[model samples]
Target: EYGRDNGIRLSAVWLTHDPEYPENLPAAPLVRYGWTPRGELAVVYDRSGKQVRSFTYDDKYRGRMVAHRHTGRPEIRYRYDSDGRVTEQLNPAGLSYTYQYEKDRITIT
Candidate 1:
């Protein structure tokens, strides 16, 4: 399989077969990737075409991931300060954590 972004190989899995039955072996995609218009990875799917994860980017900040969701896992979210530094994080357990940044140090709580 190839990615739509740059024609790059995304995922490829081929079954092995006997030498005489090479034609019986077929290549299959183990994973698939979906890209945003700016070429950012937006979503992922398993070989069965089940959604694995999806990413959400911040509209005001390019390339900034504001949240992501994974199958069977809790969704994680992030909040960025004006400087584009992560200021707050919400974990899968619904706990909120805050971060502070200084010129040369970082403080998390």
Candidate 2:
């Protein structure tokens, strides 16, 4: 709600512990939506409010799944360059990629 309403991405969703393990981690109903903290659109707090993930968008603004948050995964590790470009993308397969951006373009291998 706060992310879209003011363009301020909600960093944390603090809540008390519930009787559910991985199923009840969140204390409230999960609502998915788009978020932009600094003009970076993130599919944060997706439906069920239990999952979150980020991706890169092409010029056409298509959602490309770059990273994500899932149940049983309590930690997230990702990085972006000073120019608001993704420097690293980590996936479960250990298949990750680094981006090298130079003057309005991205170089990926």
Candidate 3:
């Protein structure tokens, strides 16, 4: 509720606790949020303060995600239409997948 009021929405959360591990082990949790004001996803960071992933939004508020990588470049991207539908996606291998939307159906190519 507080997040929504601040124009941010919680999308997902991950928590980890290893009971069998040593007590000195560090905790690693992740949280993701979406910026509601401009309809973009805010960056998610790990407990160590390193960026986990980030997102971009189109003019109409459609979102595209770019996952972080330890090395090389982030290798996933998406494009959306004005109606907030995903129109295309690019994978790590650089393969492009296109989407087609019809009044009653959606087709992926």
Off by over 4 Å in 3: 1-8, 11-18, 22-39, 62-71, 91-93, 102-105
- Encode model 1's per-residue lDDT on 68-89: one tens digit a residue: 9898888899999888999998
The residue-by-residue lDDT of candidate 2 on 1-109, one tens digit each, is 2223554555444444555665666655356556543455565565466445544444333343334555455333455665556788776656667888778787886
Q: How many collisions per candidate?
A: 0, 3, 0
Clashing residue pairs found in predicted model 1:
none
In terms of lDDT, the best-performing candidate is: 1
* C-alpha TM-score for every candidate: 0.70, 0.35, 0.51
Model 1 earns a TM-score of 0.70
What is candidate 2's CA lDDT for residue 52? 53
The total number of steric clashes, by the backbone 3 Å criterion, in model 1 comes to: 0
Candidates 2 and 3: which is better by TM-score?
Answer: 3
TM-score leader: 1
The models' CA-based lDDT, in order, is 0.78, 0.54, 0.58
Per-candidate alpha-carbon RMSD to the true structure:
4.4, 11.1, 5.3
Worst 10 residues of 1 by lDDT: 5-14
Error of 1 at 14 (Å): 7.9
**Between prediction 1 and prediction 3, which has the larger TM-score?**
1
